[model samples]
Target: MTAPLLEPPGGRPLRIGSRTSLLATVQARHVAELIHEYAPGVATEIVPIRVSADVWDGDLSRIGGKGAFSKEIDRALVAGEIDVAVHCMKDVPGDVPLAEGTAFGAYLERGDVHDVVVTRDGTPLADLPPGSVVGTGSVRRRAQLGMYRPDLRTERIRGNVDSRLARLNEDGSGYAALILARVGLDRIGETAQPQEVLPLEFHQADEGVVSMVPAVGAGVIGVQARQRDLAVMSLLGGLNHDQTARHILAERSMLHELRGHCNSPIAGYATTTADGAMSLHGMVFNRDGSELVRFHCSGSPDDPAALGSEVAAELLRLGARRLIDATGG
Candidate 1:
């Protein structure tokens, strides 16, 4: 493995690799601001990297799923071209482990993790006209929405946040509602009021009970660095949020245990309880949401990985692997 320099050659600012999307640049700037706040006088520059997944024309699953978004940035890190890489945690796939010598060094504080329904003129999801079309790119969102509201049609929509919103805002766009991540909308300052902020907690609905379990590692920003870059990692450590790191670590561990792919509808979330115990919940669903295998476990905060693994094992025993195979997840 190539050992990255302790400092950039010629005293150049440390390069932080980020995706070229607007939302990604926003996240990159946020992290840069935090870095500047924590470690003053450390010159840093945001280096945008174009990822294949961002430019791919076909469905995400066919192009290698969410991991595709991070591969190039990770390559840049491994190649010593960048000191660190910033990524939306949800886009890092569970099946593909980080490259050797690279480690997740810090996690920003958690943000709003729930998905939301944004509609033209702000029509509530339930109140939308019957047979109305809803747009989203996530299979998990599609399955859940179908289960929650079978009367509505779920269609695949793709683009950066602004482009997707444009499609929704344009007159006669044919979409009654759009499912989007609340954090993404908030990050970009898009104030299209959410028709409904889907709750994570279970509740009774007209089409039976429903809950919106977030994608694993959702609402978190991950800072990755070369393991040997002690200087960079030390600087990043100052920006780490311990509580958020614990939660994301458990979530990622569960994802690794599940080995769930992008093609599968897998959701996992971890949080602390009132007494400070760490609890993890993992769910696996069939394509149509007809069958679900859900499991939960709690453990000491110090051993969050164990808690996540335990819950994942239980879900697997309940046929999670079967669903994954059936759906190529």
Candidate 2:
């Protein structure tokens, strides 16, 4: 027999896992708020965990850190220590690497995913003076910028969103800009610093929707207490942005096929028409972002993932594979 959805478990509150970071906590609270608004009677408990990626002195460039922020919470999920864990979708690894029996329950509506340029002077990228060094931790940003201005240099940066912004806001004489996540900026209310946010449709890789990319089955927060956790699922799934899911599915599949790594200079986006026809766009670039190959495929949302994979194969045939091998990403 299954327990009631909102039965006054008056005994104990349901626990949800969250990271110890301020931003992670904020995301958890956002998720919790949604639950409280929709699912009555069930209380949420926050389980904070530490992750290695929170290094105080480690160089993000040297660590090759992928999923550094998510591994610990994922472990807690797999171990049955927490009911659900909230996460940033892009931070999720290409493959859900968690133990069986544990899965992501559903996705929250996504946020923007474009890389933004935050210049201290609020100047556009094109206006940056010569020899301007751009601060960014992402190779994608580095490559994209390189494509536009090979004269610009990429400086390795590390830390939470706040910390990165601090570095950008701080003087790096000759430093013209920093690449940041549009979602992060909006979440923290700091979108004013950058002169412009790239529109994914206009800029090869710009700001756009987010998607829940949980470890396998964890696409949504795995509100698992028992097999019939339907009420919890319904409340959250009701928030699923269908277009976001289609975009992410196609993007993830493309990443999987192209072997897109954390450091790979890869970009993908999906958009939909009023009639619901889905158009998927993806690209693979060399480390310098100088050599880029783009491909697009359209289909019904029914098989966006297949469409993504098909385009990826076409990209590979056109020489994207050689660039990946050369970059070792």
Index of the highest-lDDT prediction: 1
**What are the models' TM-scores?**
0.94, 0.84
Model 1 per-residue lDDT tens digits across residues 1-329: 22223466789888989999999999999988887777667778999999988787568887778988998998899998999999999999888879889988899999999998887676777677779999988878877776677778878888888888899888988988889899999999997555578888644346454467889988999999998888888878878899999998898888888888888888888999999999888888888666778888889999888888898889989999998888873
- Native-vs-model 1 lDDT? 0.85
Give me the displacement of residue 275 in model 2, in angstroms: 2.8
Go through the candidates in order and give each one's C-alpha lDDT.
Answer: 0.85, 0.65
In angstroms, give how far residue 89 of model 2 lies from its true place.
1.0
Query: What are the RMSDs of all candidates, in order?
Result: 3.2, 5.1
Worst 10 residues of 2 by lDDT: 210-219
Candidate 1 C-alpha error for residue 197, in Å: 0.9
Shift in Å, residue 241, candidate 1 = 1.0
